[model samples]
Target: MNVALIPFDTAAPSDGSGVRRALRRLPLRDVLQLAVVAKVEGTATLNDVSRELASERIGAELQRAGSPALRRRSLQILSVGCEGITTPGGWLIASLKAPAGRGFGLALGHARSAPVAMHDRATRKHIGSAATAVRAAMRRAGLDRKAVELVLIKSPIRLAGGGPHVGSTAASRGAAALGAALALGDIYESDLRDGSLCTDWRLHGFRAMAFSGTETDCCEALVMGNRRGGDPLLRVERAVLSDILDAAPLAALAAGAKAIFFKAGIGRSGAVRGARTTVLTSELPPDKQLRAAASGVVGAILGTTRAFISGGAEHQAPPGACLAAVIRAAD
Candidate 1:
């Protein structure tokens, strides 16, 4: 099976436009599922985004197009992170996975502060706090704990007017590691002591990344897995990359293969964002092929699934780090 990991930044008009445009340009014969992440400007919650999108006719459009509406699935794992900003004070990060076709749709959110401490180095603390909140949400939603796969955290440094800069690099990486550890249920107070969350690179499994110039102050998290049970409609396959540069060729090679799903992950190294990114692709677009690709990638990385590929490379993925794919699985 082949998968393509396409990245996109919903905050950017071009990125979002490109995706909408892609739908028009493509064959439109396959099943198409979408996942979107927008770094909102002020204090916004996951529900806020969901509500806004729902209110703005986006959900209606999907329904009209025969796509599924926003439905929250069971809680599996959780990841959180924080970043500093001038006007917003601080930003929060969280990712959650939801059922969509054969795979899941991973949603990432960024919330801006309402004048809280913005420069604190307590990124891991923020992530942990968010995780607790998510657990509460899960309980409210009636989701089980054992279904979670992993959690991811994306952290950025403080910047002027809440935009992207180099200051938040280390903080973002730390947040990622801490979030992953927490999602896997292995976090300790000592781990938070030296601010070792972002410093450590050995932590791998779940994927995480951070960027500057976001619009919101809330952190977002998404859970990815097969908790909804097996689907005779499709099957999924995943491949993890130790290096992002390796993802492109791998995806190209996998194109036109016999897999229903293909997904990848993107991460960073050191204080700077890594160059590699993840990808997911399918034999066709719009139907089971597209849905399977989205699900596979969501399950594979524990990140957002319906994102536009362009912004992902520019905003989510670092310079050279990227993930790509081709999907061809059994129906």
Candidate 2:
């Protein structure tokens, strides 16, 4: 994959209009010259990206840009990379994945689904729409159905009465997973129809990791897998979980990969291995809380605090369970 390293200074005036206007004025030749610099990138000062976005009422825009980049890019980092004592600036690094055994495969594709219905009902409609995006990514990566190993999808959530409705996110995630299952052949298309989403917990994509977010209007996915004669610089691996407490398999997978990602099912009873989880009892949304808890657990287990944990378990693995995976560099 080719990476473009543009040192963007995030310290711009309100609405970023000044920088936006300056960019518009750049001559075509100079802009083309800047395109030659590629590979890895570093940071620039983002004195107040958050404040600026808030002042402009473009939080959704910020969220939109961030979520899609994360969905499509193999590695997207926006970091200050320092302890809190004195750091005020940061970097924005976005890496694109290429096709045909060149680098890690990541595809940004979108799909639309019916919105407004409550819970699993809406997701039944999401099933068909989400499949389109999944296939698009698979095609871009030049991977046959069998070659695809992991699917990371952020499904679009539906707002009720123009506001947040409980379990709406779950609905979208269920639809997205069902869609992935169809594409990956984990479940036959004939096995699905109305009322098949969350109800049919038995149906799911063994390799798909799906989540629903309020930031997107459509489905976006990242497909990672093995390519024969692919670049040896990286490797992909996965493991299913018997329970949230089950860490043996994840540890084993970690032994073989350089970086790992985990997806844990929040049990219906709101507990991990029978000990109640605070996520269910707190006012915090389950998804957000799940992210923190799961990350903490996996990070502690692996002795690496930078773990990526997507929160959801609707048919992602066995009943009330989930999976773990790792991305390793070739030795």
The digit string of per-residue lDDT tens for model 2 on 1-331 reads: 3222222223322233322333333332212111110011112122324332322322233333344332222222121111111112222212233354544432222233334243433455567667777787776555778887787766655655343324365666787888888888888888986767667777877788776654445666666666753445566678888877787887777664544567767777787777876766787656555555666667667776444465667877876676887766555
What is the C-alpha local distance difference test score of candidate 1? 0.31
The lDDT per prediction is 0.31, 0.53
In candidate 1, which residue ranges exceed 4 Å CA deviation? 1-117, 133-157, 160-166, 186-190, 204-213, 228-237, 245-331
Shift in Å, residue 217, candidate 1: 0.9
Report how far off residue 272 is in candidate 1 (Å): 16
Task: For candidate 2, report its TM-score.
Answer: 0.65
lDDT digits (tens) for residues 1-331 of candidate 1: 1112222223321123433432343222332223333322222222224223322332343344433432121111111111121110111111223344343322222222222135542354545544553354333323344443322233333443352322453344345345444544545445455444443444433323322222223434432222343232222233433333343344543433322122222333211143322322323311122223334443334333332121122222223243332222333
